[model samples]
Target: MHVVEAPITITGQESRPQIRVAPPGPADRRIIDEDALYMATTTKASPVAARMARGTVVLSEDGNVFLDFTSGVGVTNTGHSHPAVVKAIQEQAAKFLHFAGTDFYYDVQSSLAKELAHAVPGTFAKKTFYTNSGTESNEAAIKIVKWSTRRPLLLAFTHAFHGRTQGTLALSSSKAVHKERFFPSMPGAFAVPYPNPYRNPFNIDGYDEPEALSDAVLSLVEDLLDAAAPASEVGAFFVEPIQGEGGYVIPPKGFFAKLKKILDGHGILMVADEVQTGFGRTGKMFAMEHFGVQPQLTTMAKAMGSGVPIGACVFDAKLDFAVSGAHSNTYGGNPIACAAGLATLRVMREEKLVERSQKMGDVLHKELEALQTEFPRIGDVRGLGLMQATEFVKDAKKTPDKDTRDRVIHEAFLRGLLLLPCGKSSIRYIPPLVVTADQIRGAMDVLRASLKAAAT
Candidate 1:
């Protein structure tokens, strides 16, 4: 498998090539003003309006070429407008755009389902149900878990982000901002402590002694179950193998293993939400594989379709459930989207993108660690594979300095490097898996400069 080593060029121009433009030009300003008038201000908007994108570059209406570290909030893993994915979508569209599998049958949908059932980590036979987005997929997982176990309560973790849907919002513990206006969320959802070593509730130190922290988290789970509901009443425990929106929080080793043991003891199913960590983002095809523990159910999206809207809830086949009308979606298994997903998976395998993500992650981690050593504001630098983050702090005590983090992100954006801030005061650096080592280094340089500028 040959990885693209040369800097990506669009239309014969080198990556990050300079482009002339008038700042906040007519097109950008007009669109921004129109958007503010027509669209709800629920979601935050970036300064620039995107015109077009190729590879890891997002060309804005103002003619700025920004190296997209966000990847459309971690959706474009195969990179923007990947030729193979584009070709598949176009070819599929020529044949049929939407078949509405709830009403009709489609080969593409079945093929994608079979592929996911096989690809997701597990030795047992699995079944899959599709959805339009990550939140929908998570919502579907919740229903499946309840139906399979005949239980109502679910166990989630602190600082975990499931999604914004009413049902998912109930499980998400990231921030109040996403749930402030929304009330009366889905009930029977409980929160537990995630094994975050940095702000560990146990106050443990260092990665070398992860067992103690793991024990504390496991104990908390047991205590929560005892207080809230009985073990049999809990349907499943939803966990993001690597917390994407939660500062890329990678739990300690043996954490999941121990948690899995407890859930198994109580006959509670484990549901791994790989919405952000799956599809080679974490180097492995599935993040749960790193723990050697198979989830009874799994949810995936984001990179699964390589920027297309698609998600899946997969589960062990042995779980008793009816397919007659248990759940359905209008565009869940759209043929065109399925084709895009199949092509994305093919590209990942044939191009060895997972291996590339792992290799590049090593280089990125080392470089970021060096920056952390130099910057006092960089309190912690941690991640798995390509899903990485550097948390800003006011001092060595790890006090969250959201202002400094925001400044760093803003400065990097102005310098043609786009970054996404996650958790409280952390900047998540999740670039495309197709990104080259040099691109990673270039982005790092921009971040380093941005941190320095923001410091003063």
Candidate 2:
């Protein structure tokens, strides 16, 4: 209905996508041109103008529907515009909009906070600090750890992306462009290696020797604490259970537990940036659950509000700022956002989306690994649950082949399957949990077709 020339429709359960014409056609250009003319330059992956979406199907402005594998960059875990979430948004909008819940009392805000505290993995008494996005959640975590531990230095991993804010940005070292003009990031932020199974500083193949990779990284952390960043001065060790922007890199099996043990000995706290991996993206409720370690602070945001702008820093109650005004935001618990959050939680529970993520993730992973076997360019296929990716390589040495990856993305787009890229030369396939086995197979088939087209 969005485009007169295009009558194509796609759904979350099937891959029967039809594209009468390539995207960025006449119908997509008016808005795309206007956005280019007026909008600030951001990470605009493609010009597929999305008019509306339902479940995993994105109806573009041109009426060219796409099988959305990006999940709106992992924010819509329950699928796009679920009827329950939309109804909650509608009902809440009718009641009241803004009430500064940070200063005043609100039942919905408190209820959602309690739900998050219970939902996030941790046995200790936890509290939630609401924010509008993942960066702010991480920002609150940074402030809390510093205030609680009173340490000047923070530890993070190389190729780690916390956020774009100054404090979280200081902790982020994933890409040089993120901090290009930003000079002298927050001081005393120590950087180190993550236990990447594919490639690492030690040149150990992580797939073959995961334990060794973990041990070498652990040894370096200890040396850093003893040397440049003294344990007495480090506040917390900030980590991603699964690196998001850096790559869909999964740390070795016991890496986080071992790191937690070391940090525990040094009087340091662990902060898991679950902004991207939270809300059942990685088969578990949170990726930290995958590691079996409870972080003192867990920063979450992406899927918490199911498309609404909401985020929370759920930390152990012991770390709550001693004073109220130490860190507060104006719209921490906006009423409508809370309603959407509550609805998202219910949808996940009633629909059993977390279990679906695990089941569908197994299917996706198997298919991707199969693609790896078929395509020599696929250097590595790695991830947990629906959060998956394939790294492109020039040869067996695994030199990044970004051109091929980008071309494949463009080719897939033309064929009606939308995807997002990650790391140096990889495409991440993070379809919503609601996606079906048939949809997964169809998407992979499209991927194979695009791969062949890109190769030529």
Q: What C-alpha lDDT, on a 0 to 100 scale, does residue 321 get in candidate 1?
A: 69
The digit string of per-residue lDDT tens for model 2 on 144-228 reads 9989989989999999999998899999988999999997778889899877888776874443588888888899999999979
Best by lDDT: 2
C-alpha TM-scores of all predictions: 0.94, 0.97
The digit string of per-residue lDDT tens for model 1 on 334-440 reads: 89889999999999998898998889888889999999888988999988888889999997678899999999988887677878889999998888888877788
| Cα lDDT for residue 357, candidate 1 | 84
Ten-residue region with minimum lDDT total, candidate 1: 8-17
Candidate 1: C-alpha RMSD after superposition:
4.8
Q: Single out the weakest 10-residue window by summed lDDT for candidate 2.
A: 5-14
Residue 374, model 1: lDDT of 89
Give the clashing residue pairs of candidate 1, or none: none
In model 1, how large is the Cα lDDT of residue 252?
Answer: 86
